[model samples]
Target: LLLLGLMRDEDTSDPEPLDRSGVDDDRLRLVFTCCHPALGLDARVALTLRVVGGLEVPEVARALLTTESTMYQRLVRAKRKITAARIPYRVPAADELPDRVHGVLHVIHLVYTEGHVASSGDDLLRVDLCREAIRLARLVADLMPADAEALGLLAHLLLTDARRAARTDARGRPVALEDQDRGRWDRDAVVEGTAILEHALGLGPPGPFQVQAAIAALHAEAPHWDATDWPQIAALYGELARIAPSPVVTVNRAAALAMADGPHVGLALLAGLEADERIDRYQPFHATRAELLARSGDSDGAAAAYRRAIELTGNAAEREALTERSRRALGR
Candidate 1:
């Protein structure tokens, strides 16, 4: 939803460098206002978590034990009500800001996730969304300088966004991470990300964002794909699974395990999720499964998985890429 972008349109320009030196209590004032009382408690809570809490629609669905399609309908219904009622956005009182900071962090997180890889778009990445999310995350980190999660989330975005230049090829076709040219990455962003990550980890116990930042930090620190500390990444993913416990996290952990351990190790975990139905339509799950199956020499299975992934992909080029992978799997 547009809510995942800027809370308002006017904040789009970063005319000058951001100030991270002090706290701004009202940095995410709009986040608290999103939980308007007119909406039903469940819908408000879900919407707040989505708009403010940073949870993805699918993750919120899982929290409610409902399908994402069902959850999306509820979200739409809530938004319509808010719009019809002309709900006002107000900054929370200073006393109320503490309770809502976590939700604001999530808002930034989900926005970045959507921008990192759009759910439905011709383009693989939504640069506008990424920029907005990063800007908001910077604000939150600056305002809540003592909050580790805020610092971790900012680090995560910076570390991940650092690869934007190499994520696609000269022709704009999305390149797989292993195939991406590391030399093209933004070194400045990586340096900043690692520095923030170190400071965040030193603050206190790691939360989901900090753990994820650690994982991204490992990837950023690697000189090359094979040089990546996959075992450490896998371990961090395991920690993240404990902290977040979502299908996305689970799938990612499996992928990291595949890199750290073997294709078989990843396959074993994915096989358990195959019957869950909740992730049957999730493109990444199918894509990851297809790759692992291909590595395990299950040509038929790989081809089937790849076709499923292709069918689920919204991007035309990505569909074509998956189709090509399927063909190779069948041939090999």
Candidate 2:
């Protein structure tokens, strides 16, 4: 009976684990290990997007606020350093996985942030980067099955990615959550994300990523934006802020409050955050602020905020989207 049960377990288990111990893993390890703190942030961003996110050289350069030649040189230098240092691409020892995971989280965070509100051109969102980060997160989660943080990170990315379909209109203009077509959401992503989130929660009390994942999941399960559990989302965001406070989190929490309470309350919170040095040039800061203002019936101020957001945009698609918002806000 014991032998029969063992056989059954073997059959039901995953056929293959995505082990981070092969040559490819070694190369990935080398890339992150070579990422010296001395390098420029721009160079780091470019290398990560190219090597980790599989972005083309041109795409990376465009995103980095530099020409292709300059971007290529930076990548070459980064690669040379990895080769010279003889950095191995293999996964760190189990004892070192936590530290290694911190590094991986940083890179994935950078990739996702770039996608959320690109630093340079026109389009606001980079679906490729977002997808790549989710892929990387999955690999990390599989490698550290016992780590709640890994599961949480993957869950958060998956749940957020599920919203991509409703984030924009047919013309790629930004679609406010309240006006988004819930029917258009990516159902598969939501289902997978929900499963990942449940696993993360089962592992332990929620961590930062788990809280964010919960917020995303709430948004995902809502039949429509109007029916969203805004109070729960606000509470989750509050927990996230305590765990990983940032201007971005604060803004998102305020937005959740606005949805739950009223736009005026949300507007005050947004106004209070206007001078936060961390968000001085972040396009989404202005974009969200504009959205609140627009809702508050300050069309002229909203138009100005939207225009500033346009000026700071990086992706072409995002720029066009912001321009449309500005035009509409200005009643042009």
Which stretches in model 2 have alpha-carbon errors above 4 Å? Answer: 1-23, 34-51, 54-87, 116-125, 329-332
Report the C-alpha displacement of residue 219, candidate 2, in angstroms. 0.7
Error in Å for residue 80 of model 2: 9.7
Model 1 ranges off by over 4 Å: 1-32, 35-72, 80-88
Q: What tens-digit string does per-residue lDDT give for candidate 2 at 1-332?
A: 22122223433334323344542554345345534344455555666677666567876765544577888898877655544444333466566677567556656766776676555544657777787678778777877888887888888888887778888777766776778888887889889988988987998888888888888889888897668899998888888889888777888988888888877877787777767654756667788788778888888888888888877675777777677766776677
**TM-score of every candidate relative to the true structure:** 0.81, 0.76
lDDT of 1: 0.77
What tens digits encode model 1's per-residue C-alpha lDDT throughout 142-195? 767888998999999999999999987776678888888999999999999999
- The lDDT values for all models are 0.77, 0.71
The window of 10 residues in a row where model 1 has the poorest summed lDDT is 13-22
Best by lDDT: 1
Error of 2 at 72 (Å): 13
